[model samples]
Target: MTRNRLWYCGITLAVIAVGLASRRFPAMLPAAAGKYPGDVLWTMMVFFGLAVIWPRLGVMRLTVAALAISYAVEFSQLYQAPWINALRTHPLGHLVLGSTFNWPDLAAYTIGAVLAMLLELALRRFAA
Candidate 1:
């Protein structure tokens, strides 16, 4: 992989780890910290995952695509077919395809996409 792609991959992995940790150790966090960070980090991971797939893409495009995808996944929770609900019962599925819909998650996704875009721009400036 190219250096940029490698960086994105590493970032994606790091975000995944932290997001999982946020869920795994929620007791260590304040009550207000409930699941919001994980959702934001999840969308951030999606942004970085897209960057890893298309490292040469513009940050704006990646941000749009990531937000589109994250929003779509969140909206998809409205569908509750047996197969999908069964899939959601699994740990990995629960992580990827959340079981329910929440308005706040859309905001979290937007924040994450913007944060990812800013991070990418900052990294590019730093590297240059």
Candidate 2:
């Protein structure tokens, strides 16, 4: 495979591995949370944009979709909608958004997606 494809898989796999490993090990994420919201948001955009530009990767689209899915799940918690809310209480939900919904989370997702799209356009120009 090409270098960009390999980098894409490596970064994606490392992200997953670290995420899972940190769950079992339980100490890595809080430090990340320490980052300024602006920095975190920018990093999200950069990584997501790179995902689109990298050979055989589509990080930007996936990043936006993932944020949307996360937002939907978080919003669903407002309903106490039986299965949905119950599912929200589990570890996966905590990993995604925490136990409650906030209007700010929607704003974050929108901002993240918009930033990702803009970054993708910029990257495409450079790539071309």
Candidate 3:
């Protein structure tokens, strides 16, 4: 594959590693590093995933799309229907669909999206 492809692949893999670390090994992290890092990284991964699939998408458009999807997912936590809640009980589903709806997650998603936009801009400029 091309160097640009490799760069994107590497970034995606690094984000996955960070996301997993933020979630799975909380004890190993700093005292206040509970769900915050994971939440931020998770949204960042979403942005990176979009870039991987659609490299030419502009930063503004990508950021808006990422935020909209992340916000929708967060809002989805408000629905505690029996079946959906039951699905959330499973490990994988729990990871994907968080149990509680926190307003702070919106801020975290925004931070992640902004950071991803800046990072993407820098990468594109340097690559050029």
Candidate 4:
């Protein structure tokens, strides 16, 4: 893989780790820093994941793809078939495909996607 893709992969991994940690050790964080941060980080991870897959893509396109995916996944929670629920019971599955749908999650996802896009733009400018 190219160096930029490798960097994106590393960033995605880091975001995943931090997101998981936020959920795993919620008590360690401040009371104000609740579940929303984790969701936001998860969306950010999605953005970085797309960046890894298509590093040449522009920030706007990456943001759009990531937000679309994050929104779709959140919406998918509305369909609670036995099979999908069973899969959601697994830890990894639960992390990727959340159990319930919350309206605020859409806001969190939008915030995360925008933050990710700005970060990428800043990084590109810095690198240039």
Higher-ranked by lDDT: 3 or 4: 4
TM-score of each: 0.94, 0.48, 0.88, 0.94
Q: Show the lowest summed lDDT stretch of 10 residues, model 3.
A: 1-10
State the displacement of the C-alpha of residue 31, model 1, in Å, after optimal TM-score superposition: 2.0
Count of backbone collisions within predicted model 1: 0
Clashing pairs in 2: 51-59
What is the lDDT of every predicted structure here? 0.90, 0.54, 0.83, 0.91
**What is the per-residue lDDT of model 4 for residues 1-128, given as tens digits with 9 covering 90 to 100?**
23298888999999999998999899988888679999899899999999888877878888999999999999999999999999999998999999999999999999999999898888877887
Model 1 lDDT, residue 26, Cα: 93
If the candidates were sorted by their lDDT against the true structure, best first, what order would they fall in?
4, 1, 3, 2
- Alpha-carbon runs more than 4 Å astray in model 4: 1-3
Backbone clashes (count) for model 4: 0
Which residue pairs show collisions in model 1?
none
What TM value does model 4 have? 0.94
lDDT of 2 by residue, 1-128 (tens): 12255554565455445445645654545765432243235334345435635554554555656566656755775776677667668877655545666666666656655655565566567767
> Model 4 misses residue 93 by how many Å?
0.6
Preferred candidate (TM-score higher): 2 or 3: 3
